[model samples]
Target: MTCLPKCAVLELTYQCNHKCKFCSCPWYAPNSSYSIGQELNLNQWKQVILKLYDLGIQAFSISGGECLLKDCLPDILRFINEEGQTRGLRKEIVVISNGLLMNDDYLQLFKQNHVHLSMSLPGIETFAQHTGVDNANGVLHWFQEAKRIGLNTTVNITVTKKNYYELFRTISLGLINGASSVLLNRFLPGGRGLIYQDELALNKAQLNCMLDTAEEVLILSNRYGFVGTEIPLCAIDSPEKHKHLRYGTKCAAAKDFFVIDPAGQIRTCNHSPKVVGNIFHQEIIEDKEYWNIFANSNYHPTICQSCKLLNMCDCGCREVANILHHSPSAVDDSTELYVARPAKP
Candidate 1:
């Protein structure tokens, strides 16, 4: 059993400027943009980062309602780089933003720090409406600017029934805007998405069609020189079309990835609220007690136990499995139904 290395995700602030209807964090605590708990100060965050590095975690991604909301983000990045350098440890830093608050100055800072940017652009008008951001044009403008400044850029777009038709257009936009890659995510049933579940959620057949379209778009985008990466589960849904896509690679979250909330609570992934431990109170990686949490939480899905691609698929995200079965231990059958033969070498 190869235990995957870990990557750290720091949530600078839970305060987001735009209220996207599909946002899960917002739904976790309604009536307020900020979390009820105290936000981690500079020193506290520094400790968390340093501790993670000491625990053998090297790569990190900073996100939030909008990571830019934190005034200390630059300082935080600077500290991480400096500390990492001191230890002779190479670290990759990434930030996921809505592209609403970043400007030329911000871009320069990110470039100077060697940070990769993952920007979110839901879709066209339909996505804009869902996020309550009146100016989708403004978001696109920054995306182009970020690329111009020589910053590596990736686009994250959520797929839903409302914007399913524009899937190709969105991929095209990302490529045109110089996005190195694009992430097509299925609309998870949580947060603001819960209200519009009926309107935005896709049935089994509809989801299959969407996955097929995604594969076609990815092929077209790659042909034109754009690197396209689809969400694991979505790609798994249409294995035949995405057969060229690799499987059996360890998930990013399971390997070299972790998410820390604004208050410094760390978990395996953002979608999971299961708090493995808090960076503020404990060094989760070094503490065998905390690491055991994940060990006890089985990764192999019951349905996938006998599947040839069981290791390849990892039975999709744990959060997704729980959603389908209404229990943490329940296995999702969707992956089994959608599994297909791997592409011929």
Candidate 2:
């Protein structure tokens, strides 16, 4: 509870090109009066990275509405890559993008810096439906190019009601196109996703089917890796069944990770809208007190208090719980929609 974070998510900009229905950027609200309009410039980003490095955070994940949309992204990447080289630090850099803006230069920077890149691809057939773009094929081609260049390639598939059925095809396509891994992300009904939950959120049966498909894919394929993020442990088969699968029983929030928004405000996690403090305004960087307080939090639903899998599931994502239940620690009783506890328990 008193340690530094191993990784930090830095939102370089709130500006994005695509208008995906499930876009979860916390600051993005189309009709809202307030938004995260202020963004840190390239130099400010460099300073923040240096401050994080000084605080012993070795790994960083950079994102944006679309990180590649930033004109100075190459400069930012160059700064981070050059600093990593000069400091001789065991730096782990990752970039998450929609893959629409991916180019040879971006690929070159990734290859030059050992950066791991994950492109968001709901499904090739349904890309336009999900991302409001018809360039799925083009993005896949870019992924192949990135793979050919020896960069770590991954695809992020957000499983929603619209794309749940095509989950396997999406994963298969990504693997066939030279992706080393595919991440099946759960749809958190926060930020923009909150507004589209009725149309996008997966019900219990769909969620199970998605997990089942993912498990089967993992078992059959040995070369490709599949990870389900923010999935309830109870929704999937045992961890022993899949070697590459990763799921969190509890929310990482301020525990294992923290997200820095575009304006330098630090949230417990990317999905969490709760602002703990700003990394620059507060002494959060130098000390672990801010994270420690939230790390030790124990509030939970009454139903979870006696469940056998309580520790294993942590009642799923607290951010989603907060959106539905009005408290991060409360349960939505939507187990019928996702998971269920034993009758006797």
Candidate 3:
């Protein structure tokens, strides 16, 4: 468990331009995300990246309320790109943005640095309903433009009751237009998503439909992609059927990757509000005890302890469980929503 993770997400800033109803930035929630001007500046952020690189973390994801809102972003990207070049290392850098601020310069920078870019597309026809803007076309256009300039792109989709039916079409539009791959996250209520939970949440039947649609599209398109969030293995209807989708099972928090907020606080994952420690103030290895919780997390949804798929699933995101019931030992909300085990594959 003392071994470092492979990727680190640096949330550059909480400032954003979009007002999507499903915004997951911690600031939009009941608790304040950070002090108004407490976010690390360009030099401090540079220090963070250097510290991470020294810790042997080679991949980084630059994200935000909207990353483009950070004036230091271009500098941060340039710094990472230049550092990798100077070190003769091919560090992986990914930027996930809302796409309202994407432009040619950013695309070209991503192309030159080999930074993979992902754009969040909530839905096609109902995109305006979620983001308060009818710019889904513009997102697709950004994909086309990214392709034209030779940058790798991904369409990041967050599925909820609001966009459940349009899931497949959204994938098709992105892939056909120019997205090289897709990343889907079935909504986990947190931050702003918490307030609108009832209106945006997806149930078991609807969740299955979305997965079914996603599986078909990936196979038919023959593209490379995977789901970005964890789901219960038992809830998955067919083990063989969903195996190819490569979404998530069990939990990868603090294992495969971790998140660092704008104020330099380490979180178990992006959705997790828990801060393990700050990288600048202390050595990350000093906080191995905090990561132990995730490494040795309890079986969520007590029933998962006896399920045949116990080894393969941890009863979905514990973060969701914590958010809903506010107890570390509580079961995931999906446990109640999905009553029966998915009839074994």
Candidate 4:
């Protein structure tokens, strides 16, 4: 049986604490302005979640400019947990945050609900450079606290040109700080990321170097897991992982992982502009054709159709192609252009 995505990402809020240069928020810009429009209330978000549950999605991830900022967050988590339990669905909840606002009370809620936690780590000294926050180390402490409380923690490092050189170090520090796994994400041009795309984007060579290090980290951190999302599969150190990566590492959009923005808009994923429907509209939710649009759209490029590695990489990321060519369906192998850099021990 083919493994399909069974997750949904809910952008709880567009408001954030850090002014990361590479942030992918649609309305965010460096310090000039933030959170442009009204966001869906807690009730509205619940409706979205309920619809997703009906769709047979078992995994839900809550994110935001900083998801922890919402005062109703604990209630939100509890509601989802309770609803999933009542329905007898084995739901997996994930919370993504910068970790600065995390505390004992929130940790308790997460622990009680069995939520997996992931914190953003920009890099060592480059945290300030990437996040535009001085107290970067403070954010790192949240992961430790999460681990202390027995919550499964994963460290997310958004790989950009500014922090590409420090990728390995960031992964090491994350593991040392008690993170159970590390997810290295390729930087995409969106939100504030578009502001400095040229400067922040990683070249193919640099990404390959990062992947090489990813393989080494997997070997070194035997107990910990490593995944480089949105990176080319050809760049991976092990051909052995390619088959599994084909299904596991593909864009969630290509599968069925839906996204609900703070505004209640349903998208295939954050990177794609195509809005399948709005959760606030019951008619839209009930209409199968609206969702079929997302399911029908083929993200794979024609260039990718003939390759044996087709499933492994899927021609990089569609959202990236959307940004580079102004068409989500266009083909772009930007990863192939970068000159490979040497991997560090």
Candidate 5:
């Protein structure tokens, strides 16, 4: 476990059924140049789980445009469970999905296998606007059912300008529906997100507003959660105030985990198009240089290196840096306008 990644995100496929405007998938971009890659077969996927477990990966996050689109997921989960049981290792599995396809049968199967579900929510009435899906109400119903069925479910809200004002109300509804915890994410420009950046991206003022709303809502709900996106310490007026709010705080990409796409290529993280290497070819557990690429070596500057908050902050999304500045290590835009701006009282 010392040299290995503690978690590995295994993307089942790139094909998703929803036209979520904020989707970062490159192929989802309008007039996009990228196309879907070939997915790992059931047998190949079983091999992936086996190798990942051997590499001491403690958790496997199953995701895709929509993972349920894959016919072999149940079998793949069975493989993961069987592998964990056989090796007597503490293996964790969480499925990141839109929750549209999760039927009762799938729910029972997930519960039986000890799977955690991170379902995307579009905020109270902003669902149709954000997801381009009309069944927003159904998403909440399924979330409540999952929690009732005894699944550790997380309500994932991707904050955009449209849903920004509804942040608190959204978290409240999710909590009322029995969400075990809540996760907040700010829209980062990339892939399809680039096409919608002007429409969805939040500004510094909005980011501060979100932090205030999130902190207040979490305190009121008394739920266990955090804003799951990497935000720079300098972006917030007082980063210390959010300690109780539980910000994602630091970038955990290569430090804690790495992402593997459908073609077996490893990315710095899911939003990053920079493929580190194929899981079949890379020495993930032993390669320190590979790990260094995501440690913000290129993004951090002299000022950042000298800052006290440097260790706890990654400046912001490395993918955002790479996308906007063409340098993965470039200073985060969040910290560019001001160095430690003040938040509203």
Candidate 6:
């Protein structure tokens, strides 16, 4: 088996200070046992990270309703750095946070551990509304602090109908704040997001418009030496540019990444409910079924099979296909749901 550079996303805790309108947790489900307050202890986290390293995983991003809420995240980073050194694993650890709980001490901790920090900044004013916060100035302040302290910083903007128009402005702000990169994510229609689907999700045309704007921003970033990181899965226009963006890496979730929930259930992606194995007790790479599912699942939309850009656009998100199409099939030429029509020969 080929050893790939795997990126693991550890959801430290589901509990978040901000209750956004597009929250994706099944918080209100009557039978749902998941809690925002749940978290893995420091020891358990160490074990999981070590196991993943043994399996050829090289990078990891710690996320949550807000990772800073764990209180022990600083210690976790220190442990990871120590363990990673002993194993010869040059792991790139990233902490995905809401930028609310960060302080100068935490920034120094991140610097000491060589940790990259990614902040969620949906938008300026509209994002504040979604998070129920009056202003986004505090988040921006932290971004500046992280940059000043020499921490690699990135901004994640989850685009929705409410703040779609602010896409260009958000990108500009990210650059001004010294963010190394910016990621624009589309709102997934699940959890609290499902309730605001009509208000939060954009139709095909609107999505195209957003992409158009993104292209211009990318050019601007290039001119100013800013690295723009747009989510390819949600990009609806500029298929060629999407292809260029992928370069050599495949979907991060295609067996290249893993998500371990608070209860220790392992999944290939955050959106997947299926548990591949348990980091608490089992080796996921040893499970034949786990590999089979990942190998068999195709993310390419049906139209992509025939499109020249098949390799570039990995057919979108696998979770989308599983949830929307009700199957784990590789979106070959037969699947029409999200497939873009190929140009007539």
- Inter-residue clash pairs, candidate 3: none
Clash tally, candidates in order: 5, 1, 0, 0, 3, 4
Model 4: CA > 4 A from native: 1-5, 29-37, 234-249, 285-294, 333-345
* Top model number, TM-score: 3
User: What are the per-residue Cα lDDT tens digits for candidate 5 across 57-102?
Assistant: 7788998879999999999988888788888865558889898887
In order, the Cα lDDT scores of the candidates are 0.66, 0.73, 0.80, 0.70, 0.77, 0.66
Give the top-scoring candidate (lDDT). Answer: 3
Worst 10 residues of 2 by lDDT: 28-37
- Report the lDDT tens digits of candidate 3 across residue range 152-255: 88999988898989898999999999998889988887778887888888888888888888888988988756877777765666657764478777678888
Per-residue error for 41 in candidate 5, Å, reads: 1.0
| Candidate 2 structure quality by residue, lDDT tens digits, 74-156 | 88777877877778875658899988877898899888877899888887777898788888887789889988988887888
At residue 209, what lDDT does model 2 achieve? 79
Candidate 5 accuracy as lDDT: 0.77
**Which segments of model 5 are wrong by more than 4 Å?**
1-3, 29-36, 282-291, 295-298, 334-345
What are the per-model C-alpha RMSD values against the true structure?
4.5, 2.9, 2.4, 5.1, 3.2, 4.2
- TM-score, candidate 1, is 0.82
Better of 1 and 2 by TM-score: 2
Alpha-carbon shift of residue 261 in model 1 (angstroms): 1.2
**Model 3 clash tally?**
0
Considering TM-score, which of the candidate structures 2 and 5 is the better prediction for this target?
5
User: How many backbone clashes are present in model 1?
Assistant: 5
lDDT of 4 by residue, 64-109 (tens): 8699988778878888899899899766698999887878888888
lDDT of 6: 0.66
Give the Cα-based TM-score of candidate 3 against the true structure.
0.92
**Candidate 4 TM-score, true structure as reference:** 0.85
Residue 165 lDDT (model 2)? 84
In model 1, the runs with Cα more than 4 Å from the true position are 1-4, 26-36, 223-238, 243-255, 283-301, 323-326, 333-345
Positional deviation of 328 in candidate 1, in angstroms? 2.4
